[model samples]
Target: MTRSVYVTSIERGDGRQIVELGVMELLTRRVDRVGVFRPLVHDGPDRLFDLLRSRYRLTQDPATGYGMSYDEASTVQAEEGTDELVSRLVDRFHALARDYEAVLVLGTDYAGSQLPEELALNARLANEFGAAVLPVVGGRGQSAESVHTEARNAHRAYAQLGCEIPALFVNRVTPADREEVRDQLAAHLPVPCYVLPDEPALAAPTVAQIAQALQGTVLLGDDAGLARDALDFVFGGAMLPNLLKALTPGCVVITPGDRADLVVGALAAHSAGNPPIAGVLLTLGERPGKEILALADRLAPGTPVISVAGTSFPTATQLFTLEGRLSAATPRKVETALGLFEQCTATGELLDQISAPRSTRITPMMFQHQLLERARADRRHVVLPEGTEERVLHAAEVLLRRGVCDLSLLGPVDSIRKKAADLGIDLGRARLVDPTTSELRDDFAARYAELRAHKGVTLDLAHDVVADANYFGTLMVEQGLADGMVSGSVHSTAATIRPAFEIIKTATPKAGPGTAAGGEPAAAPIVSSVFFMCLADRVLVYGDCAVNPDPGARQLADIALQSAATAERFGVEPRIALLSYSTGTSGAGADVDKVREATELARARRPDLPIEGPIQYDAAVDPVVAATKLPGSAVAGRATVLIFPDLNTGNNTYKAVQRSAGAFAVGPVLQGLRKPVNDLSRGALVGDIVHTVAITAIQAQEPG
Candidate 1:
């Protein structure tokens, strides 16, 4: 039987879409094939469903997502009674459920449903569909006591109707009242209650949404500007100077199209970023002349300028009632909604309650999801040295919006701010540090000099070197100002990791139980790197790919051990394979001899580990070749961690697999460091940086 979750709310305006989106995220994280079904939808496009399809990359047909429209459902209920209506919905739901491992059943919206007793109708549908009910209660403007009563009533109502409610959610409460609401409901309710505070960003309409709602023409601006949220409305009826004073950040300016002076002033102010407005909404269908439009375009390159057929008064009325919807077009809002849901809810416990079976295979999406969940669980402060880079800035926006971890962006503060503004990115609460002008520079310089004193480094030279962003960021990690550091978007791998090698250093091996009290210490660990080859079915670990050029038997064994630990940390079981040009004793060469020796040494050090060596790539991964060449070996044909004898072979093999097999290669992730510091390829995309940052944060969670 397919597991399913029925998300329903007591009334409208509960902002249940956030809960829906969050639950969808949780489901997709665990299972590969998840479907969405709405029992009764409005006539137009379903915004939330569209978002789910786009975000999760669903292949289910849109026609199968809905049972029927509100009109058809109302008429059916009115003519054939509730039983027929529910039966038809149940049949439609099962049609989708049969093809999916789990289905998310979106209950009816009470806004325009003519069918009476929507709460009971939803409960009946949920019971019929055999889904665990997750009810939502709106607390947007309600008092604590009122919200408490409503939450209790909702749970009781569902329970009485024989619906299995796993949890109750109270969304859109004030931040001050969030805890109070949760505590109050905990005392009265039998199930866990999660409370989400109201986020203005989620409620604020974007410029594109407003334009679509008003059916206006977008005269200027690109997609980035259109995505800005309209947090406030400013009616531009006064003079230019007066209008300038009234403009606020993220506010939309509503004025007549003929008012060129006000338009020019607003655009100029926006260009200066005095108070960056969302966009200008020109009313009365009147637009500026070609000359003025051209000038306005120059004033604010990407800022939106819209022309609507309605006058200012009517536009204001429409704007007041319009709210943001979670759709494919609004990605930032999706991040905000997910962040809010994850913060307020006991996600793991709730997911357990939903009880969807985990997939046997680890897809690329599942790997990425696990990375984020682990990183967000124990939030760390990570520093990015390339703050002015466009890709870094965009990734920072995603990191902050998703609440993955605390961030400190290193660069000139003014330059960073200007770049972010031009890109229309809101870096909320990200610490911006300019190494040259920062007070910490002197202290960092002193520490660097002290660490490098053996190299005869003076204070002046150390000061200048520490002024470099990479060095400054590494110092932040070394001095405990930051937990981890991720760089190398534009720098070389050596530039990114050199400071760590100089300051943080590698972990010193500890004394074992059998060692004498005053005996010499064990060999210190070497810093090696691994690439997580995310294949279609499973993830593999390829180590020493980007760090070491050549290694002896002992160092190769050490790399195998480090790679195994890194694999286990990332949830991949380690079946070690020491790759060589030959399989077993089939051929004789120095490289094969090294791999065989390394395997023996690794096994001697960790006797319980599954280690096999002198194995060809085909013998290591292909079962047919393994059976013919190295039969009855535990690690052969099932190796999750592959250690190469040299960097040349390792790097080339990983690149070949990545390009030929269409695998996602995440890393060059450095291992065996005291603290986490990872490098990125110079051509890294925004998503690659985001994943690296998450990986760094997760590595920081490990104890020294």
Candidate 2:
């Protein structure tokens, strides 16, 4: 039998799409076969259903997901009474359920339905379908007391209809009242009540929506530019200087077409990436000259420059009234919604309450999600030394928005703020520190001098060194100011970690029961790295690929041990393969001997580790090759961690797999450091930085 949950809202504009998205995410995490169904949907394009299908990779046909249109359903209900409506919906839902392990039933939007009692109708349908109810109540403009009362009343209404209410949510509550409302509702309601703060982006209008409302022409813009939400409206009646100061990120500029100066200035501001505006809207149906339009396109490539027949006043009114919709075209909005849902709700507990079984296989998306969930569990503070970098700031916005971790960005405070404002990103509780002008400069210098005194470093030299952002961030970690650090988006790897070697040094693990009499760890400590090679089906750890050009036998052993530990830390079982050109002594050479010796040393040090030696790349991972080459070796065919004989082989193999095989390589994650500090590739994307920062935060959770 297919299990199902009904996501319904009490009133219109409750913003229940966030709840639906959250539930879909949770269900997909638990089961591979999940379906979506809607009892009655509005006419036109079902944007919400389309988004869910695209995002979750649903296979259910759109025609099968819905029972009937709102008009048809209302007519049926009015003529045949409610019984026929409920019976018809139940049949459609079961058809969807038959092919899925779990069905997520999206309830009515409470719009255009002629049913006398919509809430009662939803409760009846949920009960008939034998699905648990998750109700959402709108609290955007309500007081705390009003929200609490409405929530209690909603629960009562559903319960009065004999519906099984697993949980209730009050979304779009004011931030000031969110916590108190949550506490009061949790205490007052029988079921769990989650309070979600109002997200302005959810209510803002996109440029496309604005253009559609005004019946405007796309003078110059693309589909991507059209999809951006117009968070604010900046009318360009003022001079360039004054208008620039008023510009906010995602704001749309509305001006007369004759104001070519304003158009050029706005595009230039966007091109500089200060605060990227949504697009430019030209009023009075007037277009700029040919040269001006060409210059504008070159200034901000692909930015929308819409021309409306309506004047400024009417256009502004229509734009304000036009709200953003949850659609397949607006994926960034989907991310924002998911982030808010995860931040406000007790996702793990809610999933447990929903009783969705956890998945066994870890996909790339799952790995990234788990990294974030773990980091948020016991939140840590991370400092980004490349604060001025655009990618870093973008990642910071995502991190802060999702409540991933507390951030302390190191750069010029004024410059960072201006840049963020120009980009229209919200730092949201992130602390900014100017490394050169911070009051802690002297104290940091003194500490650095003390730590490096044996190197004959004077106070003056220490002061100058500490002024560097990387050195300052490293010292912050050493002095226990931040949990970890992530840099190297622009700086070299050596410049990023050199200070750590001098000050933090390598950590010494505690001796285990099989250690020497002096309580020293069995293996000599060494710093190594691994890339979590995220394939389509599973994640494998490729070690020493980015560090240690050519490690010897003992160093290789240490790298294997560290890689095994790192693999286990990130939730991958370690079946290690010591790789070389030969397989199980089939060939003899210096390379094979080195791998053989390293395997022996690793086994001698950690007898419990599962390891194999002198394995080729094919034999290490391919079961067919393993069956022929090394009959029944445990690690030959299914190694999760591959230890390379030298950097030349490891680097080339990882790059080949990453590029040719289309796998995501998520590291060069530094291991065996005194504190958790990771580096990013110079060409890393925003999502890459976000993942690296999450990895660093998770590492900070462990003992260095």
Candidate 3:
């Protein structure tokens, strides 16, 4: 079983970064902890390592991730010999490998290094680390014959070194020659060879690079604008009309500081969306007047305007010399690179060839990934009531980008668009509905009044009440116009769920031993909720956290059953613990008695479930305590679903874990409702909203 992969290049500039990213993304999807190691690193921060660290939330210390710097390696090799250097690096590599399920070993770069025989060194390290090597060859300036030769030679070099070469890649091939090269290499090579076409966007320098290289001051811009790639540079020595003609899409315009006329003209063109430029560079430390600056602000709200002291000649030289590198600071480019790699390569075949070990533990990130993937598999429509809120809009943008579900945002349509524009969020493909004046308003009101007629809800009163966003969204779900609804980002939990209770109500009673015979049928399951408490290594389900305040034994048992079913629905095995202040008759109290009764009732109701009674929090989660207090109990310590005695304990425990232990509480995901309607906390971030919406989509998939 291979535990690591080595991504090396035949030489520098092979564009192996794309392959590295694709591998990391693949590993993360299958495993929780993916470690990164570079056998040799240059002094200072490694851009590629930093990208992997931040993007994947790697916990490995940077000092331990590398063996030695180029200078240190060279010095050690000269003083101690090559064998000693290899041995030392091997020790460092294993140190990181032991901590993770799998490690990705980035091979030494051929650029800016004092180390000798780099290819031999990489192969030796891969051999010692017991790694599979995937070598990359650059084809930017090569023909089909040259590319084929290099690919074969690179594979042979690694194979001769006794390193496992499962597959190979030929990167940066010209678009026209991509297919021919792929065919030729596929025929001759003994292993799979992936050919990637040249991507100009990945090679373009961003505005942030211009600011750093020229040592300029940022006159106006945000982080988003700074990350935009400056594809081409246009010097502003020409007249306004000539400059307008010269402006190309995503180009940076350089002009004298006093060229306010040129500045306004360029910004106006960008505002009109006519070949929008990346940014404007003001030379000679010049700035526009207050009025012109204000106009510039309105014309291009987020475009970068940098002021540099150098003349245009020196600036242009620096800009032309700049080359793009992958980093955490530029996330858009990372997405583009990953998308390109996935599209051009046979990822499934490559992964099978490498055969990375499957991980058992599910990290918080892994849980979130599963949620989104599940939601997208069979997408359902989800409506958001707080569409005008900034966080809601942001989550909607992410949901659309991930293709999680169909979204219908309920609010004033014009206001929602304006809010999204102000936040620079693209609500692409998300439908906007103004509840007050929608074409379905009268139809929805009629339906609502009919549903509540026995409760004295007249048509006039139902019409006015249905205008509220929460009620309107609930109506959409009830009418099957939308599959589910998520709200309460700004509204209270009661305000968000009250409409659901009135319209959707509890699901029609499930059949089984619990059902009645002739007319009325069985009692409906208790309407409860659960918060998916995502810890560092696993996810635990906490029941009745936000909905029920206090319940008797039967209600508590129903909550447990609902929680266990919910747990199984979301991929968690349901070993249930009825939490209390006492464990196994060690203490006596009303709380303990309630938990004890609840556990017995739950077991009677569902004999298939694993249940424990009156278990303390520590005993429920800690194996050592479980062994001491409740010996031989199935769910004493390994419980994944914990049913609290009351809301006070469940809510407080979840909040403490979320704030102190840094767990991500993805719910109060309301269960037992006829239709799926989940509530968000008033302080939920964009990520929390995204996860909740995904969970709701999954819930909507269950048979009602």
Candidate 4:
């Protein structure tokens, strides 16, 4: 079966942009079998129509067809000589309606604009045909009041003409007016209203909605119903004033005024008519300050405020686990909270069951203080590089003032702090350093001048090199100041890697230019990956994820070595599973041959690797199946580190298991680099950025 939507512009308005986006968002969720039919699409290059066609392409099965008979030719051609264009309009819409499940009739212009009669005719035809008529309103320089009034009147006209419960979509609304319009629309109209967020990104559940879907409770107030849509957290002491200013009509939890200051800032933000915050949550054992009380009295008036006496972190933890909004009875709320906590625990247990194969073979008792000695001696030093990104830098500042790690930042001092302030990134305990601000500026200048002096790098340029924070930070790892360095925020892959290759190429060659696998191999570092699949206390290791695209015989051996090395660092015993197309090499091909060679290589590289390979995907992991397939293969059934042959197989396989099997992947976490140099996709999200930062820091640890 094919699903198609026919969009008609009532007048020559720009509602099509939103008409297209909303439809696409709906399609991603609701429709699977999709096709498109544009009834009477106007001719001569209609960009809006063209853009709609582009969006439709992404939602449908990539291999379907699209028809544009309606839009390409005016309705006049379909029903000529009756009402001139009106006859054809009804005929075309009716024709498309018969073909598609739901036809979205988009009202383009107002009744007053060109062809108001034609607009009315189209609306009536839409009613007669039983289509979903959505008023998509847009104005380049028009007033919001006028556009809104126009939309409302259109809805009234459609209803009076015997249309079904119709909806109005306010298009290209100024972000500031969106909430207000929604508020106003709710009271006057008698229909379901869905506000499209002000973003072009493909729609998914809202973050708030996502939280709600997780079946969690809102924490700020006692009345869980109020916290469903959390605006922000309010710090205790200084929050009252700011709470009044910035509370975003959701739940606000306050702690000390230090925390209160955040609340005040949030409340002051709401204006003569901004979205008012939901409520206030007073946390910890602190009383509200005078300023806070005054502000709260005036700003909130009778808004409900909940008080809980617990530490801020604990308070947040409770709030997060509550499974958003509890307007229900107390007993019901308690059950929901307990259930959610248990669910989280169960997710944690799943993680604990996955262990590294043979990782417990060697356990050391003594601890070393110096990272240099630890890294070289232990072969696994967990390092955490102090970061300069907004969240990290703030955390770094906290750590520095508080003394957290041997820190390194990637830019000039003044610039870093300025950017940090602009972004409101907390410095936490981080010690800020300008690689360019060190005492060895001249020494760096002299050295860099000698190395790349001919690359147009004058003595002055050399000074800049010594002064460059990222360059200096990478140098720390190269010169053994830190065991490893993870950095890429202020630099590129090329810039981050060049310094390391120049200063610390490798103690020995990696298995090869790429990855090492196979039965034949001398001991060497090979490509591997480590993913910290975190489930509360269940932090398991998954490898060959970050490095080694596809393995040949030799590369597989290297993957084992690297995988084993990473597992040891994270304290998980290594259990290797060499996955294959067919178990026991029942199939013959270059792939099986590669897996066989790789298994042979692993036995040689890490003699106690506890590895099993040339095994089918099921036999390699399922104990019940493994017991039958390879009777005595130790790693067959309980493999944690799944080694794949190539990226086409590994990348797709991991993602599927992650989504289908309810698993999470942490990193291809770039492993086997001379120094830590990871690449971020052009459009990585903030969470991705956070994980990468942690990985880099852990890599900086000395071998011990």
Task: Give the per-residue lDDT digits (tens) of candidate 3, residues 101-182.
Answer: 8899899989868778889999999999999999999999888888888888998998998989889988999989999999
lDDT of 2 by residue, 389-493 (tens): 888998998888777889999998877875664445567599999989998899999999999999999999999999999999998999899999999899988
lDDT of each: 0.90, 0.86, 0.86, 0.48
- Judge candidate 1 at residue 399 and give its lDDT: 91
Best candidate, TM-score: 1
Ten-residue region with minimum lDDT total, candidate 3: 514-523
Q: Count the backbone clashes (under 3 Å) in each candidate.
A: 0, 5, 1, 106
TM-score of 2: 0.87
Task: Check candidate 2 and list the clashing pairs.
Answer: 249-424, 274-422, 274-423, 275-422, 275-423
Q: Write the per-residue lDDT of candidate 4 for residues 1-704, one digit (tens) a residue.
A: 22333234445444344454435333322332233433334335544334445534324321122223343223343445325554545565555545444444443333332233555655655555555555554533446566566556756876676755435555545556666666666677776333333321111111233233434333222222232344345444443554454344333444443365555444443322234444445555555566776685554333334455566677667555432322222222222222222221221221122110122122211110111123322232212232445544543433332122345555555556444433323343344566655675677677777767667778887787666555565556555666555555444655655565555554454342223345333435543555645422234455555445666677676666676666666555667777788887577889888888888777765665687778877887678998988888888877666777776677677666656765544554656666664443223334444445445555655232
Tens digit per residue, CA lDDT, model 1, 392-481: 998999899889999999998877876676567887589999999999999999999999999999999999999999999999999899
Q: What CA root-mean-square deviation does each model show from the true structure?
A: 2.8, 3.8, 4.5, 22.2
Query: Least accurate stretch of 10 residues (summed lDDT) in model 2?
Result: 510-519
Please give the ranking of all candidate structures by TM-score, highest first, separated by commas. 1, 2, 3, 4
In the predicted model 3, the residue pairs found to clash are: 516-522
Off by over 4 Å in 2: 53-68, 71-101, 114-121, 217-229, 232-281, 287-306, 412-415, 439-464, 512-523, 623-628
Error of 1 at 41 (Å): 3.3
Evaluation by lDDT, superior candidate among 3 and 4 = 3
